[model samples]
Every structure is written in C-alpha cells, then in structure tokens.
Target: MSKVFLSAKLPAATTKILTDHGLTVSVYAGEGLISHAELLKSVVDVDYLITPLSTQVDAAVIDAAPKLKLIANFGAGFNNIDAAYAKTKGIQVTNTPAVSTNSVAEVTVGLMLALSHRIVEGDAQMRTSGFPGWAPLYFLGSEIAGKTLGIVGFGNIGREVARKARALAVNVQYWQPHRLTDPEERSLGVQYVEFADLVQTSDFISINAPQKPDNHHQFSAAVFKEMKATAFLINVGRGPIVDEAALLTALQQGVIGGAALDVYEHEPQVTAGLEKLNNVILTPHIGNATVEARAAMGTIVANNVVLLEQGHNAKFIVNA
Candidate 1:
C-alpha cells in the first residue's frame, strides 16, 4: 500500500476514505500540533504528506520526503507550504479552498457582533459579579444595525460577509487589491473605496486578507490611529496581517474603540497583555472550526491525495 503521513489528525471520515482506497495513513501521535522535528522525521518515507497550515513544509521538509509526490494541505491557505520549492522537486501541493468560505465568513460576522455588543466581556462580568436585575448604564455597547463595515479582502469569504452584513442593515464598503466590476459591485451591494478611506470612514474594519509580503503588518500603529476612535477592528484572516505590538498600544491608548481577533500575529501563543485588557476579545483560531467545514476539508484532502496518486490533478492544486 502507498504510505500517507498526516502531521495532524483530520476528520475520521477523511482518513477512512484514504484508507479504504488501500493507502496507509499515519497521523502524528500525542496532542496539539506536531513538533517541527517530529514532522521532518515522519515525512522521510511517505508518498503523500497531509499537513495543517501551522506546520512549515519548506525546503527542508520537502528534501526529507524522498518519496513525497504530493503535499495535501488541510486548509485553504498554503502559505506554510513551499509550493514553489516543491515544484522544483516535482512534488505537487494542493489546498482545500472554498470549503471554509461560509464558515470563516460566519465567524467574522460573529466576531463583529461580539466586539460591538461586548458579549464576551459582559458574559465574564455576569459570571464573576452577577448582573443586578436591570441597570440603565451597567454595560452600554454599540449596535451594528446602521454602522459601516469595511472589508479588507473582497474574495469569496469577504463577499459572503458582505451578504450577511447587508441583512443586518449594515452599510458595506470593501477595499481590495483589484476592484470588482461596477456590475459586480452593485450586485454585491458594496461600494468600492480606497484603502485609506475605508480605514478612516468605516465604523468597523474587518481584515479578511491572506498572508502576502505586502500584507504583513498591514494594520499597524499608523493604520490603527487613522481608525475612528469609536470604531472596532475585527480580524478572522491571517494573524500577521495586524501588528500585535501596535494593536496593544492602540487598545491601551484607546486609539480605536475595541477589537475582536480570531487569529494573532503569533498564533497559539498570544501576545502579552491581550487577555488582561477589557476592551478586546481574543479567540483561538476557530474561523474554520465547524464540524461541517472540517469534515469537508478532510474529504478534500482525501480527494487530493487519491487523485494525485492516481496521476490526476487535484481540483485545488496549488502547484499543477
């Protein structure tokens, strides 16, 4: 049987699909993300390597896998995998795109509402001190019904977010590297705005961009300063998209109103002082944490492995 190594355990259904096809699947032992050293060792003999974005599949990992023919990533983003380097070695890389579009977009909107309404903070307060029946000024939070929402990346997830935000009566504006056609803009009910204008004018700014050289620390001190003091920042995208140090400063100085973050610049290990603040809500990366999405990604990973092994290109091949 051809060997397949998984850096992390995906849904059982996905694993079964691969195993049923007569492929041996080995998942890393123990909990949490597989350590760097272990991952390198595990890939040395595998024909197909399945990994999460947290694991780095660079030149070293690619070089170690002498029999590696395919690198099937479990998530939409393939930044962790060195696809270009893999191409030189004739090893293809594929990611499960669009599977998490609705899931991530749903989390983005949930984060927006959580921050706007201080849901997490309020819950904590109630648990600790108990809410006294009904007080007029106990916890006054902003409403999202009539606010402007600026989406950073107007891709599938961003468009889904726009569609949801419109249902809430929130005015939607988007800023992207490439503007959509006028007709597409009208259909989506979004107005294209300059990046600077979007940051300055929006009541809530959501970062939905991918990790790119130009997008690193895109939300820094200067950008946060330009945000309306009463505005909130929501990030469900790549962590490095926002500068952690600068965000801390902004929260401390009241540079912006508040922030709700799903991803962080340094993931799993959060930046210091983020949890202590009362104005911010931090979450483990749950953008695509739903069972449905994970199961779908598992299926996609299975398909990528089976198809690539059978001399067929995966539908989501990153290096075809």
Candidate 2:
C-alpha cells in the first residue's frame, strides 16, 4: 500500500474516498500555519502530498521528499507552489480549478454591492439604534443598474461575475493578456478593452487576475489616479496585485469613491490605517470558503491522489 501525507484537515467525505482505496493516510496534528521543520519531518517517506494555499511548497521542501510523486493543491491559486522547481524533480502538480467559481463570484458581486450601497454602514448604524426615521436624504448611494463593469482577468470566476452583472443590467468590459475573438465576445457579452481604458472608464472594477511577477503591483497610485472619482474597486484576487500603501493613499485622498478587498498583501495582519478607514469594505479571504466549495475542493484533491496511485492521469494536472 502507498502512503500519503495530508498537510491540513479535510472534509470527512474526502478522507473516506482516499481511505476506501486502501492507501495509508496521515494528517498533521496542528492547525494554522505549519512550521518548516514539522513539514520536513512529516513528508520524508510519503508517496503523495496534499496541501492548502497557506502551505509553501518550495524547492528545498520538494527535494526533501525522495519518494514523492504527486502534489495536489486544494485551491485554484498555485502561487504558493514553486512549479518550475517541482518540474525539475519530475514531480506532478495539480489544482482544482473552476470547482469554486460560483462561490467566489457570488462573494465578488456581494462586495461590489456592499461598497456601492454602503450596506455595512447602515447595518452598524441600525445596531446602535441611531436610525431616526426614513428621510429622502438618508443614506444616498450609487446605483448598480446600467453601469459599466470592468473585469481584470476573464477566467471562469471572472466570466461568472460578468454573467451575474449582466442580469442586473450592467455593461461588462474586460482586459486580459490574450485577446478574445469577436465570436467569443458576443457569446460572453463582454468587450475587450485596453488596460488603461478599463481603469479609466469603468464604474466598478473587479480584479480576478492571478499573482505573477508581471502583474505584481498592477494597480498602483498612477492607475488609481486614472480612474474616475466616482468609480469603485473590488479585489477577490491576490492581495499584492494592488500596492497596499498606494491603495491606502488612494482611499484617503479620494482618488476613487471606495474600495473592497477579500485578500490582502499581508493576510490576517491588515495595516492599522486600513482598519481606521470607513470608505473600504474588508473580508478575511473567504471567497471560496463556503461549506459546499470546501467540500468540493477536498474531493478533487482526493481524486487526484487516487488517479495517480492507480497509474492514470489526474483530471486537473498542472504540469501536463
């Protein structure tokens, strides 16, 4: 029987699937971030390894696992994994893409609506019993109907967001490295625009791009300045894509109306200044955190391991 090491706790269903295949599984005992020494000790003799986004799979770590054949990531983003280094050692990598698309897309739309309508402010005021009565001038906010939405990356999640936005009567535009043909544009009902044009003219801008060297700090002070004063920004992608200091300055200086973020540069340790600002909406990286999404991701990870153990190609192999 082959041995597998799981870095984090997964859904019971996923564990059952793997155990039913007659494979030995060992789960790490600790929660939160696992130490490097702990990982090095645990993965020494395992044939397969399953990990989450928080775990870093670097060259040294991969080299330590002499018997390792496959690595299965629980999330769509594989930035934490050093793919190039892993390839050198003939280790296969796989991620569950499009498994949590709807869940994340729903969160993106929710953030946009919350920022545009000031939903959080209203909720806070009501909790404090400060709401006097309904008045014509009370809590005026931006309307979502008939506004232009610009998506930074047009992948599965981005496309789903556009579908929902169109249902609410919003025009959709997108900017990506690879251009979409006219037929593809017609099918998605989205226009391919230049990066500068998307930044300048969009009423609401949502980022779904992956984190790469070329895209790091893609939205800085200069990009913020190009946007209209009434425009709003929402990010459900990697945090470092937007410069934290620059975003803070933009919010304080009113470069744009407001901002919403589901991910941050230094996660779980937001800057003090960001906490003090009332114009921004923040969440604790819960875009694909729904119960359903987590279960689906776990199942995908388990299946990937099973396939490799059975001498078959994994369904979502990254290296292939």
- Highest lDDT model number: 1
1-320: candidate 1 lDDT, tens digit per residue = 79999898788998999998889989997687888788889998999999999898989999999999999999999999999999999988889889899999999999888888889998999899888787788688888999999999989899999999999999999999999999999998999999999999999999888889999999999999999999999999899999999999999999999998899898878899989998899889999999999999999999888987788777788886
| lDDT (tens digit, per residue) of candidate 2 on 1-320 | 89988888888888899999999999987967777788888889999999988888888789889999888998998888887778888889999899899999999999888988999878878888788999999898987988999999999999999999988888999999998889988998999999999999999999998888999999999999999998989999989898989989998999998889899987767756977777788899999999999999999999989999999888787776
lDDT of 2: 0.90
lDDT of each: 0.92, 0.90
Q: Which regions of candidate 1 are displaced past 4 Å?
A: none
Measured against the true structure, the TM-scores of the candidates, in listed sequence, are: 0.98, 0.96
> What lDDT score is found at residue 149 in candidate 2?
95
lDDT of 1 at 47: 98
Q: Which one wins on TM-score?
A: 1
Model 2: how far residue 26 lies from native, Å: 1.5
